[model samples]
Target: MLHLQHDRDFYAWANDSAAHLRAGRWAEVDVDQVAEELEDMGKQQKHALAGHLKILMLHLLKWRYQPALRGVSWRLSIDNARDEIAELLEDSPSLATKLPEIAARRYPAARSRASLETGLALETFPVECPFTREQLVDQDFLPDESASGQA
Candidate 1:
């Protein structure tokens, strides 16, 4: 019944599936759907971490390259991304183990995105990320905005 409901009414399927599991009616539970949902939930967290990293990296790039344009909004964006990344890691400590992998995958997209949004040449930014993962997430880190000699 739950399996049939899964195709027809997803919400009903979820409720019925959970009810069966709690009641030990394992035979009636949709194990395949439940397993898929569990896997997706884990993926969601990893994807979230990757997204936050990209945003933080994008802001960092903008801050580094466009030092004169830096202002309160950019700082807020950097801080918000930093705080969310911290909160995500604190909630899912295991995600910390994959931070390097996430950074590698997300940085290119971030660089491209920053370039597109800033109307800068893609080549303007390095092909690889300049900031280390530690510095990327560091609360005090702002990617040497001083390099551009902006006050």
Candidate 2:
């Protein structure tokens, strides 16, 4: 009934846990560690989604701010990020409700990254998110500074 110490050899612990699970050795399984691993997996997925959103928002900002410099690569990067976000949401439907929350939280980091990468002053981008939830995820959405704001 002794369990492998999770900190010492996580890989061994995982393998041993799986084997015990398959053998129906319920009492021998490391339930606490198993639960922690499952929780970690969900957290990883959320982090990944946030990361993709950050990249998407950054590229969108770059595309809007430097329209003259916009090229195929920027478009492709945006498309790729959208596709990834779509895939993640499709796989985890529960995330649909979290999209706005996640986007709101991650947008600042995205703006900061865009400013750093584009060599523009941080003040160039708005402190508040300029894009709506719809615009953030819309494949065709690109901010138009001409519509109402300065580019």
For all candidates in order, the CA lDDT equals: 0.87, 0.84
lDDT of 1 by residue, 1-151 (tens): 6667788998888888889899999998879889998899889999999999999989999998888898999999999998998999999999999988998899999999999988899998888777777887789977775453212
lDDT, residue 49, candidate 1: 95
Give the Cα error of residue 5 in candidate 2, in Å: 5.7
Against the correct fold, how does model 2 do in TM-score? Answer: 0.84
RMSD of each: 3.3, 2.8
Q: Which residue segments of model 2 deviate by more than 4 Å?
A: 1-5, 8-12, 148-151
Worst 10 residues of 1 by lDDT: 142-151
